[model samples]
Target: MKYFMFLIFVLLFFDAKGQCCLHTDLSRKFDYKVIRLDHKDADGFARESKIIIELYKKSDKKLFQKIQFKTEGIGLSNVFSKCSDDRSYITGQNMKTEILDGDYGDIVIADFNFDGKEDFAIKYNIPADVGPEYCYFIQGDKGFKKDEYLSNQMLWFPWLINSKKHQLISIVSPNWGTRIYKFQYNVFSKKWRKIGNRFFRHDEGLDEELIRLKNI
Candidate 1:
């Protein structure tokens, strides 16, 4: 009888749900749900993925698919948000995803360039990206804006801004050949100006050279 009771206990334990606590804020106010993996048998923990829903309140859009990515180091942490719309995805594999830490840097929505309405000024890190360590401040009005300069040999740190304006986004890809590109409607000149620093790309080895990585 004791053995039978033990079997029942094990069954109940396996049937329990794994819950992860998360607090996410979006450019538009939202409610999110986070799901993790369940161990079929008692073992340890494998990397898990989280899904954040915008809770459209009245929209019919759901995450119809997922793509997988295998990175060299820590893998893609939850740090990478749905930076763009669903159609922004550029891959065809699905894998488990998650973030070990909840800090997603500065997500302030502001008029970073002092246009008029709120733009954005998210300060995040691509510490692993090959260039110099720098925090990315991506602003958003029509699109996004990233810091022009890049640093090297980064450090492990978290950034937070005191304002409640910026809505955080991703950093410019740190791969050697990348640049922060921005398009502007110059009121004074009445012309559309595409202005920014030069791009950086990997040539052979050691020394860093400049190259264009293309626009989104």
Candidate 2:
């Protein structure tokens, strides 16, 4: 009886449902589901080092698709650019897809373009002192396409998505205190532009400002 019960429990666990999460934002909200995966490429490497994702409708989980391209891995600095001499950074294919840490990142599903259909963003939590790398994909009738406008940007660290105003928020520190920049997204041009700016000390709460902007 003990063995039989264990078998039944295992079956129920596997049969319950696949792991997935949904986005609950306002401006670019959609009813889509996300399945995040941290995979290791079997290229004779000892460590598991890659990220894969699946997106599908919440109502119909069976119909889902995987991300087409391999991630360029978590960056140490600006892997896209070399600041010392302003030269481009080139790396081998294997290094590009390796995982930086156990927590690969998250898969966010929403309508980033104000369209009714949903879009997806892979926020790679790079194992650096700075923020993570971002990759956005716009959904179409057939499948998703990489948004070059967003991909080319050197946005690092964590960022917040404001659905009501369609803005992306980030805090920057110069020689003085910290400055908050509210970047609004332009769907037609597929770019981000600063709309609001504020300065605060290290002790001030930046999140409070983010919440306050939703009303304006």
Candidate 3:
């Protein structure tokens, strides 16, 4: 019985040691002031990770809002290196630039909907040739809500927002294709619309070379 108990204790100790966490202060970046990421160490990756986001009122420094979500895993080395440099898994620059450069990070902070409120995207899956998939959340009067349109259409590939044109652009890989979606308000229906999708392939300096692709 003593030996069995000792073995059990050892197992528990190793299990506890295998679990690690990374955190960052995002107060300057978004309303969610801080974020904590928890995961279990793998051979070369982290698995079963959870991201916890917290927001505080600036005036009192009191807790205002908290959100948590899960991810399958991410590259262990990448997460650790980024965390060591800044204690954050989030990249400091624009996500569009990183994606265009073929560098994918853990989180992206941006104003996704042109709502004047900041939004964010979390990398929740391993990246493919298209790029890392992200869970996009939009900020609202209540709180952040997962946006299906953005998550499905825009977050999968390297994308950018053009506030001046009210357009979102996505660049597809391998063939170097492009997709553009426009957002506009309709005076007749008294509703906002996300319409006018256009696609183009690598021009190759010739109009005939342009290939029209189906919507992704």
Candidate 4:
């Protein structure tokens, strides 16, 4: 019995500390790639990861630009299993990069700051209780600069981009009802501001309803 228990404990120890590392493509724009490294602490919690972005130009095969950032723990958002008596649970969260094929285009491209040039909208699943938040890269003469304005804004999951109007819409339900918030870029202030909102039923799709109502 003692040997059997020891073997089980050893297995769990390694299983909890499993690691993953890779470099993957994120967009078709000049073939941007992300280098991701995910590590877990001894207790099996996601510690942090290094995410680096590399953009290359095909003609010369030259690395044009690079961006790097570190991930911070967003805290536990999920509970997989719970102990009946104590209610302790196993939770998991990671700041991993999105896997992309040749044509899966989830990235939003728009002139968010109304500069007449295209900018990229990327979502990051930061430490959050609900869903993923968003950030953007504004196109510049050299490459792109991270927009601090949108990065500091607070928004929640189930989000969509309005490319025509340069808007970001998000929906959240804390309790029994849902609240919708629409954010638009203010060129003068160089920030995003909430422009509109509405309450809707769970059955209705927030993205679809927002598009319809905003058109009217």
Q: Any runs in candidate 4 off by more than 4 Å, and if so which? A: 1-29, 74-111, 114-116, 126-129, 154-160, 197-211
Point out the higher-scoring one by TM-score: 1 or 3: 3
lDDT of 1: 0.29
Model 2 per-residue lDDT tens digits across residues 1-216: 553354356445534322233322311223333332234346633132234444434443343566645445532222212111111011111223333322123543445566656565665435343345567777787778877755555243224556676776655554445666566787677667667677887637866875776556
Candidate 3 lDDT, tens digit per residue, 1-216?
A: 553354356445534443222233433534343233445555644556665655555455455567777765453434322432221223344323323433344555666666567666666665545555677777788878877766666655334455555545554444576444555533345234566565656634323422231222
Models, CA RMSD each: 14.8, 13.0, 9.7, 12.7
Candidate with maximal lDDT: 3
lDDT of 4 by residue, 67-157 (tens): 7665454223221111110100011111132422111122344555667665655444443334445456778888889877666653342
TM-score of every candidate: 0.26, 0.49, 0.57, 0.58
**Residue 124 CA displacement from its true place in model 2, Å:** 3.1
**lDDT values of the candidates?**
0.29, 0.47, 0.50, 0.50
Model 2's alpha-carbon lDDT is: 0.47
lDDT of 2 at 29: 20
**For model 4, which pairs clash?**
74-127
| Candidate 4, residue 52: how far the Cα is off, in Å | 1.0
Off by over 4 Å in 1: 1-19, 22-29, 36-127, 130-179, 184-216
In Å, residue 213's CA in model 2 sits off its true spot by 2.4
Candidate 2: worst 10 consecutive residues by lDDT? Answer: 82-91
Q: What tens-digit string does per-residue lDDT give for candidate 1 at 177-210?
A: 4443333434355333444333445424212322
Per-residue lDDT value at 50 in model 4? 50
Number of clashing pairs, model 3?
A: 0
